[model samples]
Every structure is written in C-alpha cells, then in structure tokens.
Target: MGSYRWNWPILLADPYYGWIVSGFGNTCLIAVLAWSIAFPLGSAIGIARTTELRPLRLVGTIYVEVFRNIPLLAQMFLWYFVVPELLPQDWGHWVKRDMPYPQFLTSVLCLGLYTASRVAEQVRSGLEAIPRGQHHAGLAMGLTPAQVYRYVRLPVAYRIIIPSLTSDFLGVFKNSSLALTIGVLELTSQARQIEEYTFAAFEAFATATLLYCAVTGIVILAMRQVERRTRIPGTIAIGAQ
Candidate 1:
C-alpha cells in the first residue's frame, strides 16, 4: 500500500552486481557465437538459392521459409525440449543431462539457425543486386560460375551488403534475450532474477536496458566504420541514415 521506492544502489551490491556482469557476458557470448553460425551458414544458403540448379535452390528456399515463418520462441522450445527427445536414447540422455552447458549450446544453435534464415534472405538480395552484365562478363572471361562468385560477384555483393549485415548482426544481440525462455540465464533472465530477489523491478531492468544500449551503440559505431571502409565506389550504401 506504500508508494514504490527506487533503490538504485542495490544494483551495485555484491551478488546482484555479479549477476548483471555475468548476464552481460553471457549475452555477448551468445550473440557472437550465434553470429558465427549464422554468417557462414546463411551465406552458403543464400548462394545456394541463387545458383542455376533448381533442387539446391528449392532446398535453400524451404529452409528459409520454415525458419523464418515460425516464431523464435517456438524454435527455442523445440530445440531445447523437443529435439532431445527425438534423438536416440543414449544421445538424448547425454544431451539433456550430460552435455556441457546444454542450455547455452542449445540457445546458441537455435538463435543462430533462426537468424540464419533472415541472413539468407539478406545475402540473396545482396547477390541479386549485382548486375547481370558482371555475371556474363565473368563467364566470358573463362571464369567458372564458382570462380566468378569467388573473384568478382561475391566481392561486390559483400561490399554492397555490409550495411544490411550490420543490422542483422545487431539483431542477434536483441534476439538473444529470447534465450531466457530456455533457462539460459542470459541477460534478461538475470534481470528477472534480480527483480525476484530485490523487488527493484525498475532498477534491475533499467540496468539491463542500459547495458543493451551500450553494447548496441558500440556495435553500430564499429560496423559503420567497417561499412565506410568496405564501401564500393559508385554504389550508395543501401540503408545509410
């Protein structure tokens, strides 16, 4: 029945402070590890989707559609709870009980694969943005399609898409909060834990919010520098502010 009181100092107290730090560390770890998976896998899928072969492209398309359409929280649950049961008995037991950091690994995998679908679309669009003339010229120069992608088309496409990829990269950090659903004890989960114990809901989550903003701010600055360096002449950055 009393007015809510703010206690900002509690955020700096011992275990609570450690929780925030650990949560921040886990958040960063998840985002980076997930991106490691998303970048290459998505890039490969995108490339596959763009190729002349119909079956390969179809497979890539299906992967994108399935992952993209489903909600991420559902994917997290499926990976952590359902996939283990689907595995063989011994392996399933190992995954559910004995695997190292199972929650962390599962969260990383689910988030990575989910983000990969979006990244695949980005990559596909980036590749398609290349002019047909370059593709034809590369072929005329006796370059294999793969070689053309390696030497000419991919280089330009990557440069053209750096800004877009930067957004995708930032998205991983925000999306990673969903890891809390799988008991990953990530940033958002830690914030909730702090609230449960201290009842300082505002302080706990305000700290988490500030931490997220700080991380994203750094990422934006770094990626902007990268985009500036990698920008191709005569091509405007697609989503520059």
Candidate 2:
C-alpha cells in the first residue's frame, strides 16, 4: 500500500474537512450561550448562598451540591435521554416533536449548570472577601438589599474575582469537549470524522491542537485585556493596608 500523503489544499477545500471549522464555530457558540445563562444564574445562586435567609442558603447549597457533584457527561445524557421519557406522556411527545435540537439544548444546560457551580463558588468567595463595612456602608446610605448588592457588593466582588473568573472561563472552554460525547459535533468530534475518512491520525490531531490553542489563547488574551482595563491600582493596595 502507498503511504497516504497529507493534502493541505484538499483539507482546506473539502466540505467534510470544513467540518473542522464549523465544529470550532459550534463549540464557540455553545460556550457563549452557556455562559450567557450561567453568569446571571450563577450570580443569583452565589447571592443565595450568601444570603441571611436560612432557607435561601439551604436551597443554594443543594443546587450547588446537586449540579457540582454530578458528572456533566452524565447530566447531558440525563437531559437528552432520560428527561423526555420521564416527562408526562403529552409533554414528552411535545418535547420530542418541538425540540428540534435536543442534544444542543442538553449540552447548553449541562455545561451551564456545571460551570455555574464553579462560578457560584467564585462569587461566594468574592463576596466573602469584601470588607463587612461595604455592606454596612450601603445600608447606611439607605440602599435597599437589592440596591446594596447592585451598587456596592457586586462591583467590588466582580473586581476582586475577575482573575478567578478568567480561569473558570478557560476551564469551561476546554470542558466543552465533553459535549462531543453526546454528539454535539464540537472540534474534537469533527477531528474524529477527519481521522475516520482520511485515516490520518497525525494530521487530524495536529489540526485539532492548533485550533484549540488558537481559541484558548484568544480567550486568555481577552481576559487579560479586561483585567488591565478594569483594574484599580489602589484597590489591592487598600485591601492590603
């Protein structure tokens, strides 16, 4: 048998090979969509976790434990397969018919919740790190609880926690590969297809590594830019003092 040559031009032009680009696009889409949901939800969960109300704290704890402990792959499988069956018969039928993208939805929900647990923890830590005087000052300024969080607590907490949040985003970007297990056709999944068709393990994997690195590098760079733009020079100094 002749050695199969790597054809760069063919890789670029072939639609099947184009799946790699499309896969990266799809992966980015999923990550953004999941984060959009996760950020607000995670912030709320974090607040609940820190609330003075005992019941809200309990609910937040349970939410974090349930989502965080469960494997995300298992959650995806549950959402895609088990949920429809477990629903009421009419609802199941409706979901089966109307749910055009069950796998994608499952991927988003699972990824969002998984990431949110982490974000929740980050937010909680950020809140705890804030001086108690900040909350007191907000109250003294006649801010409602909501106003206190909105105007004072969140601003400081976010500033303090951004470095941690950047790490979390990078982690989620990589973890998105898990969606391929449920047929979401992300970068890794597309690479598998290329390997199947060309039997070019080295080429296929090499392409994937470069693509992932490019995306991950961009995210890191963007986060660093955000950090530099928003950073307060005296805040860390003040905290230390």
Largest lDDT belongs to which candidate? 1
Which candidate achieves the best TM-score against the true structure?
1
Q: TM per model?
A: 0.96, 0.91
Clash counts per candidate, in order, are 0, 0
Model 2 lDDT per residue over 1-241, tens place: 3676766654675776779888888888888888887888888999999889999999989989998898887888888789989999999998788877877777888888888988998999999988899999999999998899899988888988887887787777778888998888998888888888877766777888898898888877777777767776666522233
User: Against the correct fold, how does model 2 do in TM-score?
Assistant: 0.91
Clashing pairs in 1: none
Candidate 1 per-residue lDDT over residues 48-132, each given as its tens digit: 9999999999999999999999999999999999999999999999998899999899999998998899889999998999998
How much is the lDDT of residue 55 in candidate 2?
98
At residue 173, give the lDDT of candidate 2: 78
Model 2 ranges with Cα > 4 A deviation: 1-10, 236-241
Q: Tell me, what's the RMSD of every candidate? A: 1.8, 3.2
| Residue 51 accuracy (lDDT) in model 1 | 97
Worst 10 residues of 2 by lDDT: 232-241
